[model samples]
Target: MTSLLPRTRTMFPGLTEWFDAAWPFGERNLVRIEEVAAEGEYVVRAELPGFDPEKDVHVAAENGMLTISAERQARKEEKGRSEFRYGSFSRTVALPRGAETAKIAATYHDGILEVKVPVAQTEATGQIEIPVKKD
Candidate 1:
């Protein structure tokens, strides 16, 4: 007699339904974000899996905010067998103080997207002093 323990979904319909409802079998989507501060720049690393560099990435900066968006094409094989499909994500972060927007750069490699922004330099102005006379 064969043990029907692992493949006993039919025996526990309620448990199978609960598990499926809690976490769909096919919809796998996740995004990991990391922020690093260096001496002269602030670096942000985003993990984007199964994404095309040409048509699925967008990076922009406006109003002191930097935005990164990425999308992945849906696989045809996952049409009916699984609930998971193509995923897309967008994240925006505020530019750090003294960060130079003009010198920002981004590169994607090995499923990791890295953005480097140069820190801005604030010039110190000379202080003015007023002389006080005793009345």
Candidate 2:
């Protein structure tokens, strides 16, 4: 997709890319994720800088919903002007259809979390017969 910013020099070029946000001198607490499907599976990659997996982050998958949450402690005190950072953050990404939720796996490494779910085999042996009469 071509960015509008390249075509026109609008006042707010970043408006089109608002999801790529920055706050408080480039410090952000929002969790960002990128997902891709390849090799009969979908892999989701998320970034949570300066967060501990053992104590700070929680990952869960249920009913085709994937949730990633984290809580970070306040680091340093701002004297004059401070952009208050959020302590806790949660990002829920809906899994694509046919995701094998029962075989999902997640791991965190170097501030990046990767979750993988294989695509379920979708096949129909025969059509179901529906009766007009109700039981």
What are the lDDT scores of the predictions, listed in order? 0.76, 0.77
For candidate 1, the TM-score is: 0.64
lDDT, candidate 2, equals: 0.77
Across residues 54-116, which tens digit of lDDT does each residue of candidate 1 receive? 789888888899888887766667446653436677888898888888899999999899999
Q: After superposition, how far is residue 33 of candidate 1 from its true place, in Å?
A: 0.8
Instruction: Quote each prediction's TM-score.
Output: 0.64, 0.62
Check candidate 2 and list the clashing pairs: none
TM-score of 2: 0.62
**CA deviation > 4 Å runs, candidate 2:** 1-29, 75-84, 124-135
Encode model 2's per-residue lDDT on 1-135: one tens digit a residue: 234355256576556554344532463437888989885798988898778888998988888898889888876766665444458988888887888888988899999988898887667579889879878
Query: Which window of 10 residues has the lowest lDDT sum in candidate 2?
Result: 20-29
